[model samples]
Target: MKDIEQYLRQNKPETPDEGQFIIETNARLSNVEGIKGTVDAERHRGRLMLVIALVAGLVIGCLFTLFVVFFPVPSIETELSAFSKAIVSLKEWEALLLVPVAACAIALGVFLMNRKKEVL
Candidate 1:
């Protein structure tokens, strides 16, 4: 132990700090903090936009589904049967499109909501 201490004392290296080291460090930290704050603000804005998009997609999907399913327009046979025929033709694919859109909205919402925290 004495020999180890003696060797350590004899071979100790000197590390010198510059006179403005603290000031420079603080300045760099301040700049980093500014950047961090900007990053956080942008992250929050992006999250909000994602949430809005998800909600809007879900709402639009729901309204569209409801309109397609429940809302019926009464008309006479003398009216435009051709337009009604076109709509009836599209009814088969409506569910196919709606299910995927709703799924995408829910998937995006869940992915965004469950995002991992990167910086603590």
Candidate 2:
């Protein structure tokens, strides 16, 4: 264990603000009440932008997935139609119905989540 630790210490990539980084990054973050404080406002703005970007990317990804599933592109329509027909033809009635039911369930779930947030 000691040897492994020493190897890691010697070979690890050094970061800027090494000691401060070690202390701040390793410390348990806690909200200290009654300490009205201000630091670099730009950091908070950058954090907000990062969050927005992540959320936007997630939303766009989901939208793209749904769009592909629901709206087949013209180039792929023949292939998609054949696949869709195969599914309907091969599966039992109950099994074939599951696709639409699953889509409805997902829509309902998203709707309910949005409704709850609106109420809150």
Please give the distance, in angstroms, between residue 120's alpha carbon in candidate 2 and its true position after superposition: 40
Candidate 2 overall Cα lDDT vs. reference? 0.52
Clashing pairs for predicted structure model 1, backbone only:
none
lDDT of 2 by residue, 1-120 (tens): 999999999999966667676566545343222222223343454455556555655665565445445644344345656667435433424444455556555655655554454344
lDDT of each: 0.67, 0.52
Runs of candidate 2 exceeding 4 Å displacement: 1-39, 74-120
lDDT of 1 by residue, 3-120 (tens): 9999999999988867899999999999999999977876786677677667777777676656655644444334647577447634645665666577666767655654533232
Clashing pairs in 2: none
TM-score of each: 0.55, 0.31
